[model samples]
Target: MAEKKEQPDASKDEPEQIVDPWRVVTTSEKGVDYDKLIRQFGSERIDDAMLKRFEEVTGHKPHRFLRRGIFFSHRELKNILDLYEAKKPFFLYTGRGPSSSSMHVGHLIPFIFTKWLQDVFDVPLVVQMTDDEKFLWRELETPDVARNLAYENAKDIISCGFHRDKTFIFSNIDYISSCAAFYKNMLKVEKLVTFNQVRGIFGFNESDAIGKISFPAIQATPSFSNSFPEIFGEAADVPCLIPCAIDQDPYFRMTRDVAPKLNYLKPALIHSTFFPALQGAQTKMSASDKTSSIFLTDTQEEIKNKINRYAYSGGGSTEAEHREKGGDCDVDISYQYLTFFLEDDDRLAKIKEEYSSGRMMTGELKRELVVVLQSLIGDIQEKRRAVTDDIRRHFMTPRKLNHKA
Candidate 1:
């Protein structure tokens, strides 16, 4: 059953006032309020019934992210499932902003789940590197910085085990210039959305540059089939499913609003919660801050030290007090990281039980996480070493994927 919220008063002059959610600013001390965000974003919660529907349609058990509610909210995901049941073709679209050379662990959530979706559905997947977006948003000395970052980030994504024949990755700086359809779709979106609408959606102010104001269209263009005519023919009615963090919903919401106007399907979405920083749930991991997260390139010793020294513990200050009071699995950083990377459901549950009951000390809990993360990162680093420039070029080249149906 979808959780319903009271309808906002229609009489209000500004409907955006209906519910205060993440616009331009995202701030949460304890963690994001999923329930409040569901109401505010006008999306449905991914309830048990929906999960059952998903399994029945896919003929496979849902990924852990769904089972554990890591991906907690969605917009029109049921419609995508229905399409899948009918054996209709739909493509996967997910992206990264090229702001850094190395990706933190938090960056892997969507790609991990997206890879699973592609494996099951046997559909083509497109990964967009928004170098233009990074250029507009950040202070860079030259365009080369954004371009180099896009390639570097692509290497990390390529390390995620995406099927080369079935995956097509593109940098906006290159692809935007090469693809006319992309430009047309972007212009269509640019025309439909006004300056005020973008201001309302993205919290843009007069001080912001016009490039920033128009960048949403660049992101939005990928939602339509025409944007990648080589993969989906110019007139193809193929739709897209976007799996991303909830922070990105505002951009896609605008895309969905304009899709129908251009005679395209509104992109379906599955939203994941923010991967909290080592310190707490109030903020997300930053690539600029080396100490705040575990990067894909970190050594085993680096992972160990970061988890032991920096991972915020939820246990009491003293051993005796911890034994009496127990640890908080809810706010514990180590436990939260396990929920994302640790695949064994039973093991994770047991860890939670032991830690919460004070049977395990804080050092022991962090040690467990350290081991799990080190192994995961070590494997990725090994794979990333093999992703050569030629491989990167092949992935970046726009072409038809070897999709089965």
Candidate 2:
């Protein structure tokens, strides 16, 4: 009798372990389960009914990000919409942790959508440059590194065409000394949040510095209107709407829990999905990892080369196999990038169908993405060049905003 064929071990072929959603998990070869994340995080889904209500109240079509489920989760978003419908005053609050001097394309997602929200709602926007947090969290040598990076990042944010008259950008290091109320609120929040609470929320260990343990209070202080008396008058009860990635929800969750005790309005939130690394959605795009992201400063050649070399493809191993099996757009990095940057819905749908049906090759799909990104990044670079020191100062100044609705 012929010898029995040896069986292969199935466990060896299993996918890589998924990255933890809580941490900024950098490029996992296998992608994350967003559904599992939603359940674990305990955030509500952005469903059809919510979308309809959003459009009805805003009196404008929901942004493509909202319609596409890119901004998929929220906490008390309807409350903000309800306040908007009632003509009650509320302000936009979103932030950047300035760990690097240059921002990548992934950094633009929140600012772009926040700009749209400001335009539609016609409200004042306060952008916090978390230099203090970055200094504590990142392996920076001095406060100056964080401060300088904050200014550079501010320029990138200003380049997104935010209204200087209605937008206020501030670095925590610079602004903390100027605002007494900010520190007061920070103290209040710190008092309310326990050591155990922060450790549980952030996974902080005993070895971590005291600054790291207390930094959440500083970030949380901005949620209260009292922290920014320059824009919203002293002791103003103005509510805030925070647009940030889902990973940041934990910070705001702690803030929300403490809000009622402080007699402050719980800041409403709209959370976006992470912009995937060039390799895949399994990891977040890292600013330090040159191979992982397309930076705003990247040359067109770099963008083209990176997309070709690193972007994970869903196409089959062989051309004939690809034609027979078709590409999976869900896992295709190029196709995913197009969904975010490509504004034309009909065109995107057509491309998706063609690519899915094996009519369009992976090269063609990536070529389309390269063009879209090049144009987008080029426009930003041109606008950023026009952002002089005076212009940057204009945006960063803490003067009263012309917040007329």
TM-score of each: 0.94, 0.93
Q: Which candidate number has the best lDDT?
A: 2
Task: Put down candidate 1 lDDT per residue, 1-405, tens digits, no spaces.
Answer: 212334433443432222222322234445766776676678878999999999999998999999999999898898889889888889999999878899989999999999999998888999999888888878877777998999999999999999999999999999989999888888889999999988977778999999989999988988887788888777548878999988788888888877777778889899998888898876677778999999998999999999988888889999999999999988899999999989999999999999999999999999899989999989889999999999999999988888645
Model 2 root mean square deviation, Cα atoms: 7.9
Off by over 4 Å in 2: 1-22, 26-30
lDDT of 1: 0.86
Q: List the residue pairs that clash in candidate 2.
A: 27-283
Give each model's whole-structure lDDT.
Answer: 0.86, 0.87
TM-score of 1: 0.94
Candidate 2 structure quality by residue, lDDT tens digits, 203-281: 8899999998999898888899889888877854898999998888788878888898888988988999889999888
